[model samples]
Target: WRRGTNSIAVLGAPQVILYKFGHPSDAWWGVLPYWAGLLILSAPVGLTVYYFLNDHTPPKSTPLAAFLLSLAFISSCVWTDLIASELVSGLEFLGVSLGVSRSIIGLTILAWGNSIGDFVADTALARAGNPRMGAAGGFGGPLF
Candidate 1:
């Protein structure tokens, strides 16, 4: 049973990855990781640049220090993917056991739970410093 389940998970990964890479699904559930990674990787870079270029009162700390501080800002963005995968896996298990529909599990349980990290990371980054940089959409564009 375990082996079969593992095989299914391994095979399913490709479909998920391909779908995430722009398969044009209006309900693209797989793109969350890509979006999260963008936020995670960009926060440090953006904060470093902001510290250097901004004429306004920059962070009192050094560039490296500011960048490090923003590391959490970045990591928080992608942290959801790891967490969400686990959460969704568990939810799916329970849903399957209970004979719940996949569509409901995918849309409500997985989507809402995974999206929580995005919401928190976005809010945290914005509240931490520049609100503009915190936007996932804004940061993802340049990072990619």
Candidate 2:
């Protein structure tokens, strides 16, 4: 693997370093493609202009509605975190029982387990004729 001056060693595996293109001294926009940087910077500006020109009104939502939605979101986040921890623990136990290496277990089982939902959602979107969005999620989900 090619290592760059900007790369940092991966946790638990000191030999592995992830690299990003461009030097650390390079401007933030310099790291991205010219068109990508332009688009990223311009999108919000364009949207704001469009909304202002169109005189679009924001949706009216009650405090109760907002509170309930926030509560639900927080609850789901906690629930998922718990589920993921349990899953990791279970996978570790199974890997030990099967005499599998930690690296193999992490790379295969943990990776797939975490990403299965993204895979399914992307697959569904692709099947529904929104392949571009599906492709985006497929490629982008793991990065986040």
Candidate 3:
């Protein structure tokens, strides 16, 4: 049984790589590794954000404060989307220059990068033994 599984894995590996990276002549195999390194480098930045947001309960807010907070949230969302677009565009340009298709970039790089947070959260929930919650999160978290 183990040998059969290993044989299946060996047979499947090349197809998976082909689908992900395309023809060797046209593919940029370094993009995913570069992306992974970026992810690792950004971990500290994410931790810093969590540190800032974790423990502070907002004080009772006046109506003006509430309005300002809402405005700030909206502005931050806009800024985040703007920055994401620029980064994605730059990545897409790099992929095109390397002879990769836009669809491949969108499917692999963009999808994986954007979904990493949901993936991590779901994995953590599963590891914590609340697999139903993790399954639900896996199914539902991407809707937003």
Ordered from best to worst lDDT, the candidate numbers read: 3, 2, 1
- By TM-score, rank the candidates, best first: 3, 2, 1
Supply candidate 1's per-residue lDDT for 5: 33
> Candidate 2 has what TM-score?
0.45
Structural similarity to truth (TM-score) of each candidate: 0.33, 0.45, 0.51
The CA lDDT of each predicted structure is 0.56, 0.57, 0.61
For residues 31-116, write the lDDT of model 3, one tens digit per residue: 55433443454445434433433234432465633643554465456557667878999999999999999999999999999899
Global Cα lDDT for candidate 2: 0.57
In the order shown, what is each candidate's alpha-carbon RMSD? 18.2, 18.4, 20.2
lDDT of 1 at 92: 84
Residue pairs with colliding backbones in model 3 are none
lDDT of 2 by residue, 21-123 (tens): 2232334545764434444654554444344332333224755335334534654565576677788889999999999988999999888878999999999
How well is each residue in 68-139 modelled by candidate 1, as lDDT tens digits? Answer: 445435444445565666777898899999999989989887767657766777788889996887786445
